[model samples]
Target: MSAHSPLPSHELAIRVRALQVGFGTRLVLNNLELDVRRGEVLGFVGGSGTGKSVLARTILGLVQKRAGRVEVFGEDLDQLSKEGHRAMERRWGVLFQHGALFSGLTVLQNVQVPMREYLSLSPILMDELARLKIALVGLKPEAADKYPSELSGGMIKRAALARALALDPELVFLDEPTSGLDPISAAEFDELIKTLQQTLGLTVFMVTHDLDSLYSVCDRVAALADGKVIATGTIEQMLAAEHPWLRTYFHGTRASRLTLARAQSTGA
Candidate 1:
């Protein structure tokens, strides 16, 4: 096997090696290594300030890496020139933590921004594409004209998701997709993600703290600690882990409470 070979049978959508990021002298990500396979939902779970978002931004080329290689879809991010980067960026989409919608733009215009910038389709075509994406995320036709302020939190998230899907990207990055929503809404959003992943055959790299979302939507979970991926595996494997942090993270107080409640209800 070559030095680069790890899980060679799987098609790697994102690969990082010895990834280091720093804001001056303080290192954020320290010699991290990770791989995300094609058409899989890999959930990144870690405590705050563990570099989850930093890792995401580094992959997106929004932040400069101090050292190491980040390859997305087999293209080295560090080597891409400005034009090359933009060209490659068209292949992916990002749904940010707070939806990150332009407060000034209406929902339709927000979804059309990327299509206008990256695609040369005609005006009618762009409108049609925007509307199609909007509808796909379960938004009503009438919602398109409304501003971000007019929509509920769930609607805003769905609108942002619609915009993220506007380009039909093969790889999607979702940062805290279900954050700040009611339980019902969050579950609904998870269902939407699963539906879209199946329907579009997408590869999703999601950073989330929601355990229920992880159990429901993620194929694998990668836990970040000390700027490295400490543990990564299916939910069952993670649950079986004896690592202190892993145990506390997955089967913590809340989880134990839920389990006990279920046991009592079932008399098991």
Candidate 2:
């Protein structure tokens, strides 16, 4: 229930209170409460099937909540009209776990999808803006013409990220952005995320299991267990937690090696 010292409501980008979600008889999230502050990367982690993605989806209004309040940019989601909800959606972007680019569309077309839906710009303008987003994400101009089938895994992630940024959103939700890449590629992607988040002044809510990404990019981390956030703090605080799961997850053999490597790298 405790988290990093909270920001005032005006400084929060997304807030969830007293959330409860269930499927049939099984409750996935029970009385979950979370806050995402503006202009920071908040990493959300949990064991597999622990409703991490569900929380993100519920906030985005993709899944129905049994009971709760979700507020984005200070407006309660339940209070918005259909038109108002659509407007609220324009303020955020999402990069799903897998690059959800359309198989039939080129990268440029895929990036233009949001623009086409949310804007009334001419085709030429849309094309130009889409190219700019592609370039912004570190993809080559030539990659704009390629289909998702033509990209490397890393390239696909970038292309998906470009599409996510198509609307120039203020808040972004990233689901396992580095999941499929090799170590080198994952590190590079993490750097790109950190850079873009800073440059764009974005509030990011990221659902991920990658320890390296947590260390390299996140400003704060929240861990979920038993259908609620069990702990929230810096990596060092998480490592020092007394909870059994936290003890096991952060001090296990692999994590010990990572900690040792980090200390050695920093000459700590």
Candidate 3:
């Protein structure tokens, strides 16, 4: 963040270089490079099995990379000490697909998971903070005591988002956040994400196949194909691209539906 820090002064939240990952005889990501700047939403897209999630997990250290350098917040992940790594991990949040909330834990308890693991706050203070996060994500105060099973799908996503935000992370990674929701619910969630990103000055690295999300929220799009990012740019740039996959994706049937919806919303 500092002018003299090893990281670029312009604020690069995440940097990946020549990243390679393989499973048995197959390589999912090979010689891949990416950069996520601060205070922007980057929608990462790829065909099924093209490794969008794999790329995200590799950057988060959940998946091992066969090769490459991953720098986060001006520090190389592979070069950090154990304590340093722990500290760095605390600076980011993740909302996996399907919400990934703990079924047995109440909403408040779920939100407190990261705080409890990293900080030593008293019960009352932690409870207050957890509730604050819950409300911050647009959940009602009463929802805090409910279990994941009791919440609707949309509420579950909001709860998980609250938990992801509990630690006040500078960056967040969201994978397929709109996957199971109805179109209306998904649109609401997209608006919520956009609001949160602007209000919090948070950088977002999202892996999603949702055309509406990409069109409505993302500042940039990164298209992964054949083991690397083939194109990265705005929606118009993506539409203009000639990459086979990019063309098919941005001009496909699903994208047309979103276009129609946008036109209808604007009364065009």
Candidate 4:
């Protein structure tokens, strides 16, 4: 149908219906359904291996679905032609876990990878765009020339994010964006994500476990369990949920302490 030729008219940027995925004898996602709305930051949460990343990979067409319909920008992925698939890919970006930057490449070269793959531009222009993206993610210009090994944890994240933003994508898939950071650095990264989301009008599909990220940046949160989405709502709504996992997750000791501390600080 060549759905990529013209953008479809719909509120959803990504939709999954009756999805099933597995490895060998183990099932990962079963009859899972989800929707990421246009221009909204949707936080996807799950325990260590409940298939949050699997679902995201399925939507990105990185994982094969056994039985399901997956759509992005209103185009059914199963129906897209090769060229159509490439066109769809151009409209989105992804930040894999641990930044996944090439250990050998400088931040600038890493950020230019996508541009080099999907675009045909002069080296000068690519350099300029990559630097702009690095700056956009709050990295200083000098950091662009550093390799991933030489950068701090936060800088690695920012550098990878610059690569994700390289194509000026309308949709961004972030896997554990705040993982491996100190609390303060994590908070700062969350703020940067929020600012970029607002400034770019981006639809962000973030797979994360950070409660602070959920509370501060996500417009809505979806929790995965039993290979399906068990609950979806704001942080407040999640906190109020009575589901066993939700209750333990949101009201457990660490979560409770965070909530209480926020309350006390606000009162002061």
Candidate 5:
């Protein structure tokens, strides 16, 4: 084969190498490796207890890793000084599973939390930005003053998403984004994510078990098992994978409704 043109190094969003994580005697991820490219929505999936969320947490620096390195936007996380770390943190946003919004804070205030922590903007500017984020995620102005308890599952998810996008982040980590929504609501949320990703040129690392979300929005799929990413490619490659877990996952009863048979084209 002729030599392929090289992709620019700046195109890498996240790179994990020789990662190891454990809690006491129980090791979760071992020697795991993965890469997320810029401007793509990469769906991460695995069976329950496979350490998908754990891996995400480790990369975010919320959970300590026993070994290996994580680099984001081409910078080694460990090498960054305190200020550098804070700067790095500003470039990415995260929406945890279960819409982890603060019950005491209203939706608008929640959206402004990151801004308060990372930015030095006037209150008037902050309010304007927060409202924009809420609207961007499909939430109404009325929902802005409601507490978490006042929102339904779907509304909470949208409010949480608005908070995640508050900083105009280049990348976002979504953990089970569609988890508790009704089918229709989930579909709508998936569409919103796709639109934002394209319009904003945001790279998304979505950890989800929702196959429909995977099929509808992902540019590529990565399957995790036994503490590492066992396979990664377009959805068609996932359906053809010989790996036992991936075989059942991609060709299972739940995946039967996808009408697209050809390999799903990834974004350049």
Candidate 6:
């Protein structure tokens, strides 16, 4: 058998070009363009009402784009039929903002839902696969029998993540992964994302308002303002950005106060 060839550096997992979305006459995304490289984390950050979630939904084909092209794994989204769309969706996994688990299904069944719908695996093999995915997300074996309503917020998130990884997708999209959790739980979740990315070589595209999470986990951040990407770079680079919106967003009064206190304490 021949050895597997390395993937090309320029090959993108997801690409959007001049994407436009609108609801009736109200424009959401305005000619937005983005590219998510393989095995990298790209964070989308903006204040409320910036249409970040709309852009994500457009890319996922949950909503129709008014204009522009969304290409996933190099296939034009508009070119796919209903059946073709289902086939393409198997290549991605999504962790919704609230861990949208089926309340009626147990954790194992929740994770196996996709497998049952998409694959022809036997019950034994499906169970084995579901268990492996649950374990991969650090869920206890016993938790597999529990329902979503019985699990804590963190467990629900983990179970949702397990379901997302059920198909071993090449691309994963997370929306507000840390929302509504205590600081400790949120930080733990961020670390979990880092660990999973390293272990599974997954490409993560997350939309969040958590500055701490952006600084801690993101390799690069794309800031959306006025329905377009205003800046995209490392945290340090974003800190140095001269755009008024970026500066105010990243080094605002709150951050400045924190910096001043630390500086006075350390004399730096």
Per-model TM-score, in order, reads 0.91, 0.95, 0.92, 0.93, 0.92, 0.88
Q: List pairs with backbone clashes in candidate 3.
A: none
The candidate maximizing TM-score is 2
Number of colliding residue pairs in each model: 0, 0, 0, 0, 0, 0
RMSD of 6: 5.6
Query: What local lDDT does model 1 show for residue 62?
Result: 89
Query: Candidate 3's residue-wise lDDT over 132-190, tens digit each?
Result: 99988778999999999999988898899999898999999999888888998899889
- The lDDT per prediction is 0.88, 0.91, 0.89, 0.89, 0.89, 0.85
Q: What is the lDDT of candidate 1?
A: 0.88
Q: Which of the two, 2 or 6, has more TM-score? A: 2
The best-first sequence of candidates by TM-score reads: 2, 4, 5, 3, 1, 6
Error of 3 at 221 (Å): 0.5
- lDDT at 95 for candidate 1? 93
Candidate 3's displacement at residue 138, Å, is 2.5
Q: lDDT by residue for model 5 over 1-268, one digit each (tens)?
A: 1011144557889888889999999989988888888999999999999899999999999999999989899999999999999998889989989889999999999999999998899999999999999988888999999999999989999999999998989999999999989999899999999999999999999999998888899998888888888887877678778988887787777576443342343422
Candidate 3 stretches greater than 4 Å from native:
1-10, 260-267
lDDT of 1 by residue, 1-268 (tens): 1113366534888988999998888888999888888898999999888889999999998898989999888888878899988887888999988898899999999999999998899999899989999998889999999999999988999999999998999999999999898898898888989998898899999999988788889998888888888878887778887778889988898866755675697795
By lDDT rank, best first, the candidates go 2, 3, 4, 5, 1, 6
State the lDDT of candidate 2 residue by residue for 59-106, as single tens digits. 999899999899999999999999999998899999998888998999
Runs with alpha carbons beyond 4 Å of true place in candidate 2: none
lDDT of candidate 5 vs native? 0.89
Which residue runs does candidate 6 get wrong by more than 4 Å?
A: 1-10, 81-83, 256-268
